[model samples]
Target chain A: MIEVLNPTAGPATGKIMMAERTGTLDGLRLGVIWNGRPYGDRVINSVIDLLRQKYSFESVTFRKKPFIGNVAPASIRDEIVESCDAVITGIGD
Target chain B: MVDRLTADRISVENLDAAMELYFERGWTDGLPVVPPTEMKVMEFLDYAGLEPGRPLGDVPERDRVITAEHLAINAVMAGCKKEYMPVLVASVEAICHPDFRFNHMATLGSAWPMLIVNGPMGRDLGFNSGMYLLSSAGNRPSSTVARAISLLFWNCTESRPDGIQRGQFGNPGRGHYCIAENEETSWDPLHVMLGFDREQSTVTAVSTYPGPYQVYCQRTANPELMLDSMADAISTYDFYRGTYILLVPPHFAELFIQRGWSKHDVRRYLMDNCKRSVADLKRRGLWGLHSSEYDGFAGVAQAVQPGDEDRYAYVFKPHEYDRIMFDDTTLLRRSDIYVVVGGGNAGPRLCFLAPYGVSTDPMTVAVHPV
Candidate 1:
């Protein structure tokens, strides 16, 4: 019998814990972060508009990442964290 | 060896059966891999003087910390020799360099890591810097080192097509794409030009696009004429403004080097000439301001009509794939061209390619072998 080692990085740690959902958007502020993907802003703006019609939003803030393919800067992320109840970012090619 | 190893080991019937097990586990680059037996991995780690838990680097966004154990295991599976370990390790670490912005590997599925090895190590180890440079051509170091990095991309970095890797067409370059620089041209080697000692071996890993498309200039002995051909190819339409890399074969290198044209001259000349007329771009349907970056044409929107060739092309939107800059578009920024010499000894052919989805640009990491 031949013995072999598992070649993968093993189970990923990213999805190990799920974030707590606010559960309702009736009075939540929406945070939109666009990573410079094509048409992502339009899609997110449409979603925000739909949410506005379906439920009351305290406010909506939009932020563009400094560059695509890199992490959002702390300043942008901090503002979103402090000013919004929830945040959404997207990836597009 | 088994007791010392921390990775989980699976028992299989034989080498053939081990291949099947790995295939079933989704751990290969769609090719048969050598069974990463405990002894094999142990030897690789030992030769590299690495402890199993040593952290090579990590993809912070993915929360994946690539360690020595994983690299050693993957290297063995890719059929790499112990001597190739240091180059391979340095390559993974280079891409994992936080600025490497590896996520593009997923989003731009058409991309793969292309390793450009520099210095004496590659030459001493027999990595091909000559004919059929990117092909295996019976060159073990060239083929296996490239494959090892590719497997790491697939197995460790999660560059699998089924997951996040989104390249519409599976790029064959992803299979194995690597080449050593032919420093014999007597011009400064790429490493020295990038500020490394001639003695220091280094590896630069680039997130490559679809091709190392051949650029031919066989007709002329005039360096300017040859460069004009290369510049034309570089100006061809593409989705993003990518940094360009040229692989100059020996015959092509002799044309300029013999005439005392330094690498700087090549870079400046290409920067000045690697442009296409707006008329040509429009005829090809590659000209437009579809990006938000061009929302107002930076106040010169009037200068751009159907085919003006007015302003030098620049600025692009993130989402728009085809629509590009206006005016006579200069494809390469002054510092955007990276020229490295190495290819077959006789071809008038050269390779013109570029990196895609870049942030901080490609990193050249020094290799430290044990």
Candidate 2:
């Protein structure tokens, strides 16, 4: 029997897993991070507005990464973590 | 006995069944992969003196760590000879270099990583350095090496055409594009210019979007006239571009050499001449006015300048706007103009344009032969 070797490097994993869902979208502040894409701000803001209409949110914090192509700087990431209960990072193009 | 492999094993009835299974699992690049049996993989790792668990590189954004075994398996599947393992290993290391920006190549642009081989091993390994450098004509090592890189990107990064690979019009070069410098010609090889010794065999990996754009200058023997032709070829690009490579063949290099100009001189000339005005750049839709309408445009805009919203294009003084805009601003400073000599040594002078933003840096890694 011929045995084929696996080529993939395996799936991605991170030390810090995403916060578990609290099963409630009420009174939680949401963070919106724009990745410098064109519609990223508009699309994310629209999502926030939709969320606002459905649930009562304490506040919505907006943060944009300083540059594109590379990962967001630590300061920006840290600010998001410290200020908001949950975050939606816009990560396209 | 060979080192025991730790990769998950799947017993197949035969080679044909293995190929079918790999296809079904989406492991292949829509092409048949040679069954990467345990024997072949072990042999491949042994040829390169690489441990199966050796970490070649990691794509942190994608959360994937590519190992020696991962590349060896794909290299074997790509039909590479056992001896070709070293080159593949080096290439994997090169692309995963923080500067190489392998992740960005998988984005919406038609960018594919092009490999440029240098030194004696290029000829020793039988890679084509002359005419049709991009084609797979009777050259197994060159073509298979390139194909193996694509498979690595696919299997490791998970950037498939239907997935993360968002090229608007992905070119065929995505599969394979490898060429060597024509050493026979009396011109400076690319590695030498990059400060590497001429004798060392190195593989320089770069991201070229939409393959190479060949610029032809047949009648013009004058250096100024010839460079003007080349400048005109790249001037019309609306997006702010950077890190373009000019593959100047022997004949063209001869003209510059006769004029007592070195590769530095050619880069200086192009950096001075190849330019577009700020008004022209703005007209190319580089301004943020309506950039968000397209998904691809949005990403490029964001990556161009992440947090700064107003200053979308390169900031030029009012007077500077009228003057030509070099991607690196004051030219010849950054790794902007990369010159390599190749082709039939005659015919229309060909140059390749590899565009990367200010955020990414290109790299050259020496292929350590066993």
Global lDDT scores for all candidate models: 0.75, 0.73
For candidate 2 chain B, which ten residues in a row score worst on lDDT?
B315-324
In Å, residue A15's CA in model 2 sits off its true spot by 4.6
Record all residue pairs in model 2 with backbone atoms less than 3 Å apart, i.e. clashing: A36-B302, A66-B307, A67-B306, A68-B303, B108-B166
TM-score of chain A in every predicted structure: 0.87, 0.79
Off by over 4 Å in 2: A14-16, A22-26, A54-59, B1-3, B278-335
For model 1, residues A8-81, the per-residue Cα lDDT tens digits are 77767565366579999889998999876545677888888888889898888999875766678899989998
Poorest 10 consecutive residues by lDDT, candidate 1 chain B: B326-335
lDDT of 2 at A72: 73
Candidate 2 residue lDDT tens string, B1-370: 6547778889999989999999999999888999998888888888889898899987776887888888888889999998877778778888889866565755667677788889877889887777777777678888899989999888877878765777788867765688788776666788898889999999888777775778777667888888878776766553344567788888778888888888888887777666554444444545433233333432233333333333223321222322233322222223477888877777876676656444455679998999
DockQ of each: 0.59, 0.52
Q: CAPRI band of model 1?
A: medium
Distance from true position, residue B283, model 2, in Å?
5.4
Per-model TM values vs. the true structure = 0.91, 0.85
Candidate 1 residue B234 Cα shift, in angstroms, is 1.0
The residue-level lDDT of candidate 1 at A71 comes to 71
User: Backbone clashes per model, in order?
Assistant: 4, 5
